[model samples]
Target chain A: MKSVEPIFNDGFAGQPPAKRALGYIEDQKKNGKHVVGIYCGYAPVELMIALDLTPAVLCAFSNATIETAEATLPANLCPLIKSSYGFIEKDACPFYWAAEAVIAETTCDGKKKMFELIASRKPLHVMDLPQLCDEPEALDNWTTMIKKLKGFLEKTFEVQADDEAIEQAIRENNQKNRLVMEMLDHSALENPVLGWAEMLDIVFYATPGRGKLINDTLEKGVKVLQARVQNGYVHGRKGAPRILITGCPTAGDAAKVFKIIEEAGGVIVALDSCTGMKPFSEMIAENTGDPLRAIAQRYLKIPCACMTPNTRRLFELDRMIAKYRPDAVIDIVLQACHGYHVESFKVGKHIGERHHLPFLKIVTDYSPGDIGQLTTRIEGLIESIER
Target chain B: MSRSAGIDIGSRTIKLIVIDNGEVVVRKKRPSTYNPMGLCDYLLEGVSYDTIVATGYGRHLFKNYRKGEVITELKAFAVGAAHIAPSCGTVLDIGGQDTKAITIDPKGGVERFEMNDKCAAGTGRFLEIMAAALGFRYEEFAQEARLASRAEPINNMCTVFAESEVISLVTQGVPRSEIALGIHKSIVSRAINILKRVSTGRTLMFAGGVALNSCVAGLLREELGVEVIIPDDPQLVGALGCALHGQRS
Candidate 1:
C-alpha cells in the first residue's frame, strides 16, 4: 500500500520520533549514559533529565510481543499492560531493553501488578500516584512523591538533581509542551486538514521528550498547517461529522478504531486519550522556583480515568468539545481495562446530558474478531451523527 | 408504486424481505455463502425494488451492491422489533454468530444497545458447538432441550471452556438432554447479561434465528418476568426493518 502524506502538515518531517528516539538511546548507551524507562504518564521525565539520565517512555505497544506477555500474565488483563510486559519478556522493545532502570507509576491496579512482574527482571522504581488531584492532601502527597523520586534517583543512580538543573529541565519540558500544544491547537478547524490516522501517528509516534528533532518536527507541522489554512485549503469532508475520541489510549498499530470511524464518514477532530492531546495538555509552572512542585502540579492535571473523582476529566472533555466543536463523542474502553470501562458510563451520561453530543461507547479488545461489528456500529453512529 | 427490499446477510442465513406499496409482498431465506456479495447478487437476481438496505455481519460487504445504503443490525432490529410488537421497548436478538440487547425508543429509534461480538459464548454458534459435542444436529439439540426433565446448571460462558465442561459431563454419565438444556440455559444467561446493560423494559421482543427455539425463548420470559413477544419469522425482523428503512429513505 502506498503511504499517504498529510494534506496540511508534515509531522516528524525528517525521521519519525519512534525511530529517532530508539537511535538516540542506542547512541546514549554507547556514551555510557543511563537510559531510564518511563512507563506511565506520572513518571517524571524532567527529574530524570535533571539527574543526567536520558529518560524515554517505554515502547511496548507491539502485536508480536503480546503472546509472550500473555504466557506469563493472565489472559484477561488489559492489552496495554500485556503489551508493556510482553515487550519486555520477548526483548522486543529496544527502549525498555536499553534502560538501566524503569520507573512505573501505580496508575491502575493492573499496571501496579504488572510492574511487580517487571521488577522481577529489571531494576524498577514504584511511584505511588494519588487519585484525587484537587484535594490539598493529594497535592501534598504528590509533591512528597516527587521529592521521593528525586531522592531515589540521587541514592540509586548517585546523581545530583540540583536546583539549577531541575529548573532548566522544567524549562525544556514546558518549551516542548508549548510547541506540541500549538500542533494540537491547529486541529481546531471547520474542515479537518489532516487524516485521522495520520494525526494519531504524529501524536503517538513523536517520542516523549526527544528534544530538538521532535520539537522541531511539531514546530514545522504547526507552521505547515497554518500555511494550509492561509491558502484556503479545506482538506476534510464538507459536512462530515466532527468527532472527539476519548478513553483508554490506543497504542501502536491498534488504530483499527480510528480507521473504522474515518471510513464511516466521521472526521476525527480531536483525540483526548493518553497518547493524544493529554500528555502535553497542561503547562508546567516554569518559574515556580521549586521545579518539583511545578512538575507535580502539571502531572496532577492529567485527567486520567484512573483518577478518583474524575470530574476534572469530564471538565477537560467539555473544554475540548467547546474548543474543537465536535458533533459527536466516541469513548473507547479497551476490554478488561476496568477503570476506563466503569468510567465510560459516567462519560456517556456527561456527553448526553451536559454536552448534548451524540455518544458512542465502543468496548473493544485489540483482537481482530470484532472489527466487522465495530465497523457496522460506527457506520450507524456516523449516520446518527450526521442526522 | 414503489417497492423496497431488505437483505440481512447474517453469518448463517440470508433473509430477504420485499415490501411493495407498504405491504409485505415476498420473503426468502437461503444459506449465506462464503462470498456475501455473490449471495446478495443471487438473492436479488430477478427482483425489482426501488430501494435496498442491507444489515448484519456482512452488511458492509454490500457497499455499491445496491442503490440504498446499509444500516447496522442494531438499528434494523430496533425498527423491526417496534414494527412487529408496537410496544417493544426492548429487543433481545441472538444471531448465529453474535448476540445483541437493544432498547428501543418510542419513535422507533435505538436508545441503547450492547453486543457480545468479542466471543462466541452467548451466540447461536455456541449452541451449535455444544450440540455437535453431544453428537446432535442443531434441530436435535433443540429437541433434546425440550425433552430434558431439568436443565443441569452450566456456568462456563467461554465457548472453549464450556465445551470441555460438556465433554466432562458426558464422560461422567450425565444425560445428553440435560446437558443440552444446560447449554440453552447458558445462552439465556449470557443474553440476560447483555440486556441488563440497557434499562429493563415492560415489553421485550425476541428475534433472530435462535428465537425459533421455543425452549430458549421460554427461559427469557421466566428470567425477564416481562411480556415477551416473538413475531412469526423471527429472523426476518432485521431484514424487515432494513426494507422499511429502504422504503422511507
Candidate 2:
C-alpha cells in the first residue's frame, strides 16, 4: 500500500472536497489503478480500500445540475439523490466517470429505484440493506451482503483480497474514525474552540474511513483547538445561540444549511448527520477473524435514518445533547428525505417534550431560491431559542 | 420616558416602531430601495431611543449601521403578532421577499415555523409584480379582486410564468378583475401549501405589508378557516417585536 498523499489545500485554501477527492481519483485512473464510488453509509468502503481500489464517497451536491436531473427523477425526491444522479447525467462529476464501478445500497426506496436507472448507464453494484440493524437476523443478512460484496469485488476486478489486507484496513479505518471523533469532540467545549465551518469542512470533506493524510491535518487542528479552548477562545460570531444539527446526511455542498444557520446568528456546536458525526461514533473490532463481519458489524451499527426501530439514534442524540449542551436542536432534512424527515418528528417530539429543548425543523433543497426563506426561518429559530 | 425602537428593513419596505414606557408611541414605514442603509439612516435621522433591534432579510446589513440584535423575521413576527392578538397561536407573514407561517408558544416564543422563499408566488411582491405587469396600480388591482364574479383558475405556480398566463388571458379579452382574482387565488393556494408543511394553529395572525391587502387577508382567513387578526399597521409587526425584545433586554 502506498502512503496516503497529503491534501494541503491543493495550492488554495478551501479548494472544495469534490476537486480534491476527484483529483485523487483522476490520478488513480491515470495510473490504471481502479477507483470505486460508494453511495450511502451501508456500502462497505473499507473492503473496497482493502481490494487496492481508491474508494470515493460519491457526493456532488451542487444545486446547479438539479434542473437537468429533474427531467427524469421525481421532483419530490430528496436533493441528495437528484443532485447525485444529476452529477452523472449532466457529466458534471469528474470522479463518477473516473471510477471503474459504483456501489449503491437500498438505504432508502428513492436511492434503491434510482440505482436501477444508474445501473443501466454505469458499472453498478447493489447491496440490499436490512431495515433493522440491531436484530440478529439483520446482522446475519448484513454479513451475507458483505461476503457477497467481497466476492463481487474479487470477480469484477480479478484481484485477490486476503484476510490480512482487510484486517490491516480495519485497523487503519479504526484509527481514522478515532481521529475524526477527537476532532468532533472540540464541539463539546463550553465555547467551541474552532469555527463552525472549519470543523464542518473537515467532517464534510475528509474521505470517510481512509483519509489518513486528512486525519493528520485534523490532528494538528485538534491540538490547536485544545490550546485555544484552554485559553478561553471559541469560534463563530460570539454569543450566538448554540445549536445541535441532527437529521439527514448533510454531505458535500449540501452544507449550505449550516452556513445559513451561522449567518442567522446560530453557532453549530455538534452535527449528528450521517456524514458528520455518525461514521465515527462506532468502530470495527480490529482483531476479528472475519473482517467482513467486523466491517458489517460496524457499518450496521450506524444509526442512519434508513434503519427501522432506530432507537440507537435517540440514545446517540441523548449522548450528544448531554455533551454539547446546545440551546436548540435544528433538525434539517433535504426536501423529500422521508427517513430523516419522519425521524425528525420522533426526535423533535422526544427532545422538545422530554428534554424541554427548542426543536426547529427545516426542510430545504439545493435551490438558491430558498436561501432568503431559509435565512428568515433559521434566524427566527435562533431568536426564539435565545429568548 | 425610556424608549426602545425596532427597524425591520424588508426587501420592499422598511418598518420602524418606537416603544415608550411599554406603549407603542410611534410607528412608521418607508419603501426599501437599493440603498437600505441610506434609507434606514434617513428613517432614524431624528429618532431617539435607548435600545433598538433590527429584523428582516437585511437584518445583518443593519448590524454595523446600528448596534442591535439581528432578530429573525420569524421571532419578530411571533413577538409582534402575539403582542397584538395575545392569543395568536400562529402567524402568517407575507412580505415582499418571503412568506412565513409560524406557530408560537404561549410565552410568546416561536415554537415551530415554515417559510416559502423558493417562489415569489404567495407573497406581497408576487401580487405587486403581477399587478404592474397587468398595467394597473396595486390598489386598483387589489380593489378589482374584491369585485370578482368568481375566481378564475390561474394554474401556473411560478410567478414569472403566471404573469405570462395572465397576459395570455388578457389577449383573449378576459376581464382584468377575474384575472386579478385568479392571481390572488394562486397565491392563496401557495400560502396554504406552505402553511400545511408546519403546524397551523387555531389563532392565525397576519402581518407584513401584504396583510393590508384585504383580498388576500379575507381569502386567507376563509381558506385557513379561522379569524385572522390584522394589527393596526401590519408591516410594523417586526419592528414592534424588535421593540418588545428590546424592552426585555
Candidate 3:
C-alpha cells in the first residue's frame, strides 16, 4: 500500500481556529456582548442574534473530555452529553467558558437530563421541545417556547428582542443559510468541486460566529468552489461510489467515519445531520410578519429522530437521496443514542425499499478503538457498491 | 491454466486457498502468531498463483506487504457461502476476535450484515477461553459438550466474566461437560440474536473456524430451525471467497 498512492488526501486539518475564535468570543463578552451556548439545531440562533447575543453551538464532539464526564454521569450515556459535561466540569472548552448563558432544548433524554446537572454550574435555560411536531398544537407550543426563550434572553441581557430586530435577524440568518447551501451545492455537481474533508473544513471554519461573519466566510467558500469547478479541478475518485451520511451530528472524533469512507475510495456527497446540511437546507420565512413563529416552524421541522413519528426525516432523506444520487447511505448512530439507533431501521427500510439503495447503519461513539472494525464495515459497503 | 490465490490472515488463524479453473488446487491453515507475515510467507512458499487477494482482519497488512487486492470478510464470506451452497441465503462467521452475520442477495451479493462491536463476547476467542477454563482441549471441548444432556445455563456473555463464571462452576462441582455445553449455548445464543437481525432466508451457511464445533452447529440448527450447511473446509471460506474475486478480476 506504500507504493500505491492514496486516492484522496483525507487530512481533516480544519481545527475551527480554536484559540482565535474563542478569544474573539471572550473579547466580545468583555465588551458586554452576551453569548448563548446551544447544543441542538432545535435552538433558534436568530433569537440570540435578535437579542444582540452571539449564539455558539456548545455540543462537544471529542472523546478527550468523555472520561471526565463519565465521572459525573453514567459511562453508558451518550458521549456527546458526557463530553459536554466533562468540558464544563473541567472548565476546558473555551466556548463554554465564553458563554454568559446556555439555551438548551429537550431533544434527547441524555442531554435533557444532563442539562439539569449543568444548570447548577451555569445560568442554563431549558426549552420544552414538543416531540409531536406534525400535530397542529406543536407549532403553537413551540412558538410559545420561542417567546419564552426571547423573554429569558431579554431578561438576562436586558435587551428587548423587538419585532424589527427579530425580523432583521431572521433575514440575516436566511441569507447566511443561503450562502451555506450555495457552498454545499458544489458537491452536487457532476464532477464534485469539493471533497468531503474540504467541505467539512470549510463548513466548520465558517460556522463559529455572527451571521455576517459566517455568511462572508461561506460566500468566499462558494466562490472558491465555483472557481475550482470552472477550472475543471475534479477531486477524489471520479466514478467512486457517492455516499450520503445521515444520523447523529458529526464533528470532532465522530468525523472519523467520514474520513474512513473517503479514504476507503467512497466519495461522500451529502450529509443529512445537524452539523451538515440540515441547518442550512431550510430557510426561515421572511416577510411573514411573525418572525418568531416562522423560526419555530423552521426549527421544528428539523426532522431530528427525537421527534416521534419522524416521517419528515424520511421525506427529507428521500429528497436528499434524489438530489445527491448517492450510491449508498451510511447512518452514523452514536452509541447509547436510542433515538437515532432505533430509527435506523426506518431509515434503512426507506433507503432500501423506497430508493433501492444500500444502507449501512454504524453505531459508534467518540473513540478511536473501533477504527479497524469501522474500516472493515465501511470498506465492505464500498466494495459492495463497486461490485 | 492460470491459478489465483487468496490469504485470510484472521486474528487466530491464517488460511490460504489457491484455485485454478474453478477447482481448489491448494488449501492451507496455520495459527497466526506474533508474526503473521512470516507464517503467510511460509504458506506461500511452494504455492504458484498468478494473482492474489487478501481478506480477514489482517487483510490490509497482507495487501500492503504482498501487493494483493483486499476485500472485506463480509463480501468474502457471502461469495464463498454462495459458491459452496447456491441456495444458502444467510451466513454466520464467528472468527477469532469478531462475529459477523450476513444475508446474501439473490445474485450472491451482500444484502445486509451485522458485525459484533469492539468486544470479543461471542467470538472464537470467547469459546477458546471458556474451553481452557473447563480444562478441555480444543478438540475435546466440542465432543464433551456433545455428550452433555443439558447446558448449565451461563448468564454472562462477556468472555472475561464467562471465564470466571466457568471457574466458579467448576469449584461448585458442576459437570465439566455441562459447563462446556453452557459455553456453546452462550455463544450460540449471541450468534442467533445477530442472525435474526439480517436473516431473511431459511437456509444458513455456517462458515469459519467455529463451524467445526458440531455442538455449536447442532445448537444453531435446532434453535434457528434452518438448513445449516457447513462447507467441507469451513476456515477456508473467506480465503476461498478472496480467490473467487481474484478469478473474476
Candidate number with greatest lDDT: 3
lDDT of 2 by residue, A1-387 (tens): 012222243543465545555665666668677888888767777788788787777755778878888999989888888888888898877778777788888888888888898897767889899987888898889899888888888888988889999998878777777777787788787777654555555665555425466567667756766676666665666677889999887755667788888776678888887667777778898877888888988888888888887998888899999998999898888888888888888998889777888887878787766776677767767766766
The candidate with the higher DockQ, 2 or 3, is 3
CA shift of A144, model 1, Å: 3.9
Model 3 stretches with alpha carbons more than 4 Å out: A1-32, B20-23, B105-108, B164-176, B200-202
Give the TM-scores of the predictions, in the order they appear: 0.88, 0.80, 0.92
Residues B67-89 of candidate 1 have per-residue lDDT tens digits of 56788898899888887788889
Sliding window of 10 residues with minimal summed lDDT for model 3 chain A:
A1-10
Where does model 3 sit among the CAPRI classes? medium
lDDT of each: 0.80, 0.79, 0.85
- Give per-residue lDDT, candidate 3, residue B131: 86
Which 10 successive residues of model 3 chain B have the least lDDT summed? B193-202
Interface RMSD of each: 2.4, 2.3, 1.4
For model 3, residues B1-249, the per-residue Cα lDDT tens digits are 679998899999999999999999999999989998999999999899999999988888888898889989999998888898999999999999888999887656887788887788988988888888888899999999999998899999988888888889999999999999988998899899888878735699999999998999999988988789999989999999999988988
- Using DockQ as the measure, what is the rank order of every candidate, best first? 3, 2, 1
